[model samples]
Target: MSIEKFIQDGVTGWMSAHGEHSDIVMSTRIRLARNLTGYRFPIAFTEDDAMAVDRAASGVLLDTNQPNYSYMKMSEIPSLERLVLIEKHLISPHLANPERHGAVLLSEDETVSVMVNEEDHIRIQCIYPGLQLEDAYKKADEVDNLLESELPYAFDESFGYMTSCPSNTGTGMRASVMMHLPALTITKQIERIIPAISRLGIVVRGSYGEGSDAPGNVYQVSNQTTLGKTEQEILVDLGNITSRLIAHERQSRELLIAKSRLALENRLFRSLGTIAYARLLPNGEAARCLSDVRLGIDLGIIQDVDMSILNELMIFMQPGFLQQYAGTELSQEERDVFRAKLFRERLNIANAPASLEEDREE
Candidate 1:
């Protein structure tokens, strides 16, 4: 699909807000880091080497004869369009780098993307709505098998799949689940949970993964080490941890309702009011407000808004998506204005007051 079509269609598939634990779990992603045999890793690649790798990987994907598959080189795509791809999680920040020579092959549904000449020779990624780690891994493995059939992979009998990073040398898989833990964060339980999980070979990262901040109280929890575990083992371990997190978050939510129901309601309604009526919304403030509003919806404190709209807003509120949707480049201040307007329109807050009153009466 063309980037224009992708932007116009908005969020779908994994970002559609449907699946198990959709209230807490935003999505699950499985990424496999791989390198082709007989080539230097991407870090050492010259322009010629990078081009060759891209050609080989993109060629394999194109030759698959799947009508839904679309491939675009980073250089050929506009910088804004590239940023949109990153916002949608169709491509990574690294692949969108101007200095990097790479291309991305995407499925029409936007669930699967294979990045060529990224940190590794091939980075196969599959994302599913909510907590579907096993399903995501199944799809990713299918793509991996198809690519391995056409191109040689750097694999060792003892070490499993070979990757550019030694940490990913074993199964080359990174399984992650994105969760919105407003209750945990608000109650200050996340501070205790992060270190506890880290001890269990699990790491917590911001929404967009490593080195990014977690806006909207969203966090990405993933397995930290892949060197000693099988892919199935990694998935199982992460799944167990994710289930526990969901339980903890739900418990925390219930605790908030029991201990400070009025205060919680006030906070959520105030957030809803801010997003629905404010004329200017900064990205960070927008995220926090939306996060509270989402919590309200999940807890039956708000009923007028759909969860899917909130999910889409999580992406749309970003600078890249806001600019793309407006069909123009925006300064930081301009983006804030456009973002507020977008939120009001999407929320359709005309009946929100009645909905809020009705919810409170219950």
Candidate 2:
């Protein structure tokens, strides 16, 4: 799909479902890392080798008669368009990295996508909204099996799947949940809670995944160790811990309301006022504020705004997405102004009562 259609539809990937506890548990993702039987890893592949892998992947996708499963050359796409895909989690950071000769085969439903010649020969992923690890894995496995019949994968009898990284050698699966834990973050409990969770072999990463900061108090929690454990065992462990974190976050939200309702309301309303009326908005500031507004919606503090609108705003406000919409490169100042205008229009905060603004200031 074209970038404009992708954005206009707003019904792609993990963004589609409103799952259980969706207010807190944003989405779940399962990724499988695989390599071709004879080909070297993407990093070591010559130009010819990369093209060969790409062609082979395209052929396999052509053979699979699944309706609406389309393929595209990622390198041929414009830069901003790739960023839009990244923002939507339709493609990974590695796949979006510049000058990479790779292609992606994705279903029209946006639930499953496979990147050819990324970090591995093939990187397959499946995404579903909220906490659904078992379901996500099942879907990914089915796709992987279908692809296996078309192409042979590199494997070792004792080690299982062979991957570029030692950790992913066996199983080669990563199960992650995208979580919005504003309550825990605001309460400063995340300082302690995150570490304890890390100790349990779970890796906490940012919204865009590895090596990124949490922009909106949003975190991707996934299993750190995948080699020895069976895929089912890994899923259960992650599901249990994620469930606990969800419980803790809910408890923190209740405590915030019971102990300091006025303070919490004031914070939420003030954030709303700034996002709706601010003349200049930085990316980071907007993300943090949007997190507050999202929590407000969940807690019944804000009623007019739809959750889908806020969710779309979360990605739309990112710098690259902003530039793409602007149809040109933007300086930081220009982006700030563009972001503010977009937020004000989408949120319709301009028509809000003047008295609410006064109260927000108070």
Candidate 3:
């Protein structure tokens, strides 16, 4: 499958709404970083060295006889197209960097993506929808095993898997789940939960991971220390903590309803109205409003709109996607206008429950 065809398919696999706690838990991801036996780390590699690593990794992945696999060189793809891949979470920001000599192999459904010559020689990533860390890990491990069979991996008996970063030298695995935590954030409980989770060897990052900001109240929670623990152990610890976090978020939502149902309903209805009728929508504003609308749907307040549309909007509203759909580079103002138009058309405003005024009277 060509990358263009993949883009045209829209949100699929991990980005779709499925799995446990789909309302709160957005997606789960497993990433394994590894270096080739004789090659230098990506940071120190010359263009030739990167190309060699890319060739080796891509060769193994493409030869797997999987009709669904598609491979693309980073240098050959357009800048906007690369950003689209990142937006879809099919590739990481680092892999999209033009200065990096890398290639990516992706499964047709986009559940698995192998990045070659990014921070390491190979990055095997598997993502699935909602609270499926173990499943994601299992898929990633299968890809890792395939690569290890054909390409030699750097390993240390003492340290386990060798990696470019010292922190990832052990299992070389990072398991994370993206969660929607608007209730916690609005109640100011997220501030406290983040610190507490960090103390427990679990780290919370933004939606796009590490350095990105968490728009739409979406955060990624993952294991912080991979050095000493076994892969199963890491999954268990993170899973337990995530379950607790989900419970807390649900409790917080209930608290809001019990404390001030009218106010909460008003806020959510207003959010839905804004997105459904607004003439222009900034990215940040759109994210915040969609978060509220999603909360309303989860709480059984908004019954008509499908959760899948919101999920697709989350990716389609991004800059890269807007431009890709437009078939041209868009100015900021053009994007805002286009975003609003897209939301208005996609959202089912005609059947949305009458303004909360009727319920307020009761």
Candidate 4:
């Protein structure tokens, strides 16, 4: 159950699953930020203090014995392995920094991960496939409660929990959903709705969370203001907005399929062709193409493909994931070539219907 074994096992994490509603809702994640009562934030800590915090947090996670969780030091894990963990959403962006003395306790199912000595003293995260905010929150809350008994968290009566970020002060809870909104993006509606959603206190970012572009029509939407609201309120508000976005995406899909069926089909099949035949495919291009093909499968435009494979590819196609899968470092050009070959093998290009192109011609 070590991080090495977890990586070697080729686990896809929670996002790889086709959950309750896998079509548009890719995955839902709940993150809780907490700090130790006596310790300063990570930036102020000496190396020894950081290591001490790592060990203390690891001890608490191990003592819990709640399920299949394994603790490992970040220093021991390789850079590529750490990247793979980030790709799987099992660790935070800040924790990926090798200079930091930190450890992560990861659940076997990859749904739960507790980061020790990251931005805050601890970051407990629970991720589930599809739109299951309530369920995700429940799991996260269970872990938070378990740790509360053993760890003295920094809390104030006026404000609920103290965190490094001002926006996360009160509840310290961020409930977010990774949405596949290709239809919205395709119809140019996402641009309009994103600002509107932001005005409602919801923050929208690219697939990798803050400071990343939405490369595959994938966006992570979450609440920006967490201070005044309770966990339930955050979830309720996010859930309502997410449900509306899902409706809009579906409606856009139906409209495109009806109004421009030929163009939509052309785009889907062209993507499939590129995946199957291209000699070189960049990660960004692959992601965008895969998103379209996945949407096609969901809409029944393509029936022979497996949604599970596509779900898995969404993780496997990342740079770190591909490098780990290859067992070595690769240059940009090398990765592109390898990616194309890998995609063809996974897609089974030999049997992919050649008629897809013919249909476009007709």
Candidate 5:
């Protein structure tokens, strides 16, 4: 039997049963665009640093009077170790999940009241019941001064000196959140909600954040305000949108779960096929383990050659090693030859013997 085909078939069977994970469509929140008046600062951070900043921004770090960024732990990514903390931060909590806002400092004197900056624009953001509209607006304005000071040199030329992107020249703050609501969209009633949300300065995008979703199951809510509404007024309308976000998430969750279940039917899913094929291999896990040892020995590749030997080498072992003193082994040369052959075979598909592919071609 073809080793590759067997592995594929076995893996497919196993995964179909386990691959259909129970899904939950959650409401995701983030700051989008804003009126950046009286602000001077850097543009977006590097991707890695931005992600770290994203985690930091969700929590309530500073209180209103001396509102500033609260220093939290460094980012988990080791590569960005020397990176300085970005000025913005937040703390998000859901009615059905954790509820926190802004990053509060754990000071040496106490566990609060430290500041990261003095000026920036503020905007309220919420996609659930726990954070009320009043509190959301209040919290947003607290950080209005963060952008007043000097920014990193990176923001100097391309996006600098009050001539940044045309839409956000002053008070550079953008607010938005992810919402899932299909029933309204499916029944075509969503068109009605759009005019209302648009009137409130909100723009909606499709699934995964862009383009239109004909099914209208998911949407990203973002700001489109240009009429000089106060942060309070903007959030009042936004808060109205957030309050309705929960209902949308529930419907989306059910649809996703149903979709996953259908993907699992009849072993058509790739994940299921992979597992089924693995189990059906001739040596099963054991045969491959022996072959690996043989190839390693042949290629003169010892444990030192591949630092990834621990878990990967023993991922799946056959029953023979424990039963017999003779374990599967290969010389260094053998391993090299095997690898070369695999590539050669792949390149010369027509050279393969009179097999199934040829039969089909005929």
Candidate 6:
């Protein structure tokens, strides 16, 4: 079955399995490449792409039944074959290390290294909690029923099955989602946020939120290691956070813009201009946060066709992801303009080309 239906009923089952004691759990720890330091890369989508993925995370959020986000989860086929394909772009040649497992870690020219493992219960990280932990708790079977009771078959066969990570058994869905909250995380008691997030059944750790929590403004929330939650449920939960954080982030950015200072603006500007990348400037021919939604739809990573997702994606633009996701690099001026304006003309959506004429004729 397609990922959609498999996830619909499956995730609800997983949510019900939350408190089941038989869940085999394991610890998870991964690292990013030390080289990735900039903020802009794969640029955010434009008003157009925002229209495409509107307020949702992916196309998955079109279903209105589950307004609560975690009603669904994200699932990608993580098989050896799939890994080989993704490795071509996302990572380097595979390592034959048994101890570290068939670990695949690589970044674009060492800018970002991804330490991912299925058994680690961390395909990525994310979270979902209610007014209290007890209120949020559910049975493990609920999660499993909604999550298809197995990892995507495609990912399982190729990546091989792993059973060591305690937190990655059962539902085996770890969603590492990042949400901007510069308003609360940056302005408040830089220390108290950790305790607050921990109380939510979510762990905040490092730039990516690993073991213990850190001063995370952009939340990397996810299910605990080897906990029971389905892809459907995870997506639903992620949607909830995505909406809330996007709203908060917008409020914070407005606060910054309204209270722009010589020192802070310069710091933000300098941060954009001072990237040490070998290719200092990226070409402006790719999808931009404000442009390209009218042009290349494939580059739209956060496409769910919702206003909330679009708003979040727009605010989430750091210089690094903007450049990386976009096939071309960006100039310093373009970056600043993007910051000042919510949308800019980054793509020539109206330009006619000989290639397009040929396609039409065919």
Among the numbered candidates, top lDDT falls to 1
Error of 1 at 108 (Å): 0.3
- Give every collision pair in model 3: none
TM-score of 1: 0.95
Tens-place lDDT digits, model 1, residues 95-149: 9986788889888888989999889999999999999988999999999998899
Q: Candidate 6 at 135: error in angstroms? A: 28
lDDT of 5 by residue, 78-158 (tens): 111111011011211110011111222322221112222111112233222123334333433443233233222122334
Model 6 scores worst on lDDT over the 10 consecutive residues at 33-42
Query: Residue 108 in model 4: shift from native, Å?
Result: 0.8
Model 5 alpha-carbon miss at residue 353, Å = 40
Candidate 2 ranges with C-alpha deviation above 4 Å: 1-4, 7-11, 350-362
TM-score, each model? Answer: 0.95, 0.93, 0.95, 0.94, 0.33, 0.35
Candidates 1 and 2: which is better by lDDT? 1
Q: Is candidate 2 or candidate 3 better by TM-score?
A: 3
For model 4, the stretches where C-alpha displacement exceeds 4 angstroms are 351-362
Cα deviation at 215, candidate 3, in Å, is 0.6
Alpha carbon deviation, residue 210, candidate 4 (Å): 0.6
Error of 6 at 231 (Å): 3.8
Candidate 4 residue-wise lDDT, 1-362, digit = tens:
76777775655556565676678888999999999877778878888778777777777777645676798788888899999888877888799887888889988788899998888889999999888899999999999998888888999989989988888899999999999999999999999999999999999999888999998899999999888888999999999999999899989999998999999999999998898788889999999999999989989998898877887777778889878877778899978877777787778888633332342233
Clashing pairs in 2: none
RMSD of each: 5.3, 4.7, 5.8, 5.2, 19.5, 17.1
Overall lDDT per candidate, in order of appearance = 0.89, 0.84, 0.88, 0.85, 0.32, 0.31
212: Cα error in model 3, Å: 1.0
Error of 4 at 228 (Å): 0.7
- lDDT string, candidate 2, 82-161, tens digits: 77778888888889865778878877788888988889988999999878888899999998987788888998888989
Q: Candidate 6: list runs displaced more than 4 Å.
A: 1-162, 180-185, 188-191, 207-219, 225-230, 261-263, 276-362
